[model samples]
Target: MSETSALSATGATESRLVGVTAALATVCIWAGWLIATRYAMTSSFTAVDIGLMRFVVPFVLLAPIWIRKGIWPKGLSVTNGILMIVGSGAFYTLMVASALEFVPASHVGILLPGVMAVWAVLIAMLLFGERPGKVRIVGYAAVVVGVASLVALKPAGVISDDMLMGYGLVSAGAFMWACYTHAMRQSGLGALEAASFVGFWSFVVMAIIALFTGTTIGDAPMGDIMMLLTAQGLLAGCVAVITYGLAVRHIGSTGASAFGAMTPALTALGGVILLGEPGNLALVLAVVLVILGVMTASGVFRRARI
Candidate 1:
């Protein structure tokens, strides 16, 4: 091979390595966010408080970008922008945050992503005519089954009355997030642009709501508040999107997303350690199925076969 060709190959390899590392960091941030959000909801913060915190920090930090691009962002359609705001912003945050008041972090982490995979694929199929292979179909089916086992079956003694409600809310939130992901893709928005767009609108919407109804901002311990500020505001809101898109750019979307298959298990383990949330057989079963299903749905195995 020519020296130039060798250098190009090395560059591609390095890019992929960076993507893999970023994906891993994004996954950890996601898991840690769930755990921290759960702790905040159960102990100190209300859903509205979490929503404010989640968007406010990012919106302030990204003020310069949104100020220049505006909320609609020059080339993005109104429809996609609305979808992005409602799906990933205050609305989605409140749904998951309220649900966290009743359910474990494991449930939020697993159910949202598992259901989201199904919803996202279905949306793509309907809107873009994207056809999933046989493997993908089976993977989506597995995700549905796993979710059913957790939500519908709900082991006898392990559930509370509000648990079902929590599950339902989180599932709805997942649908919104699926819509957001698709809208972002359809708009061709850069990761930072997308985050700023969502954060700015969410801050405005939540602020308006706070004006009318007032907020549940809490007097939580400073240490806990600082934790949420970092986890919810900075890492999950700002950095995760950028890293995830970077991963997609280098490793391809399928390769980058397959790493998300690990999040359910990571959140479950974190719940056990940090929140003292008990892990049951059903949790284990759901986590395993969802991981395998998300990985398969992401086409990891299919790519290897090809």
Candidate 2:
């Protein structure tokens, strides 16, 4: 190859490598967030309190950057930004916190990311007229089967009405995230811009809700509060958002999203090690199936084969 062509090829390869690294880092942060949130729920902190903290710290730290960048989205971008805030911001956090109360971290790992992958593909098909090839079809089927197995094979006394409600809420949160991602792609906003916008508006909305609902961050242990503030706010809220954006920009959304398959198993393992949550045969099987399905549906494996 010509020197210029070789240089271009090298640049493309490096960019994709960076994207993959970012995607993997994002997954680890998300898994850590799940574990931290579960731990916080054991303290005096309510889900709303945790959600409030998620926005508060990030907004405080990122506000100046947002202003300096002059990053106000307009028109449909504005609408999409609002959707992103509601879908993946405070509302999503609250849903996750509440769900964690009823279910274990393992369940959250499986349900949230698993449902999200399924929804992302389904929404793309329905709204964007994207046709799934044969491999993708098999992948989708595996996702469905894995999710179903999770529900059906949950430990005894874990499938009560309240737990089912929690599952539904978590599923809703996943769907909202999928919507936020779609809007973000459509809005053409940079990752930092979108993250800052969502953080600012999420703080505003959560502040209003806290005022009306009398939701206060009760006097929890200082360590727990600090952990929540740092993990949810800085790591998952700011870092993961930006990195995931970079992943999408460099590697395409489908390829970046394929990394989500690893999240469930990682979260489940984290829960077992950190939270003392039980890991069973069913959870293992579900994780394997879901990861395989996501890899296939997102065309990661197919692309690698090519």
Question: Which residue runs of candidate 1 sit more than 4 Å off their true CA positions?
Answer: 1-9, 128-130, 151-158, 216-218
Extract clashing residue pairs from model 1. Answer: none
Best candidate, lDDT: 1
The C-alpha local distance difference test score for the whole of candidate 1 amounts to 0.88
lDDT of each: 0.88, 0.83
Which predicted model would earn the best TM-score? 1
What's the distance in Å from true for residue 104, model 2?
1.0
Each candidate's number of clashing pairs is: 0, 0
TM-score of each: 0.93, 0.89
Cα RMSDs of all predictions?
2.1, 2.8
lDDT at position 301, candidate 1: 89
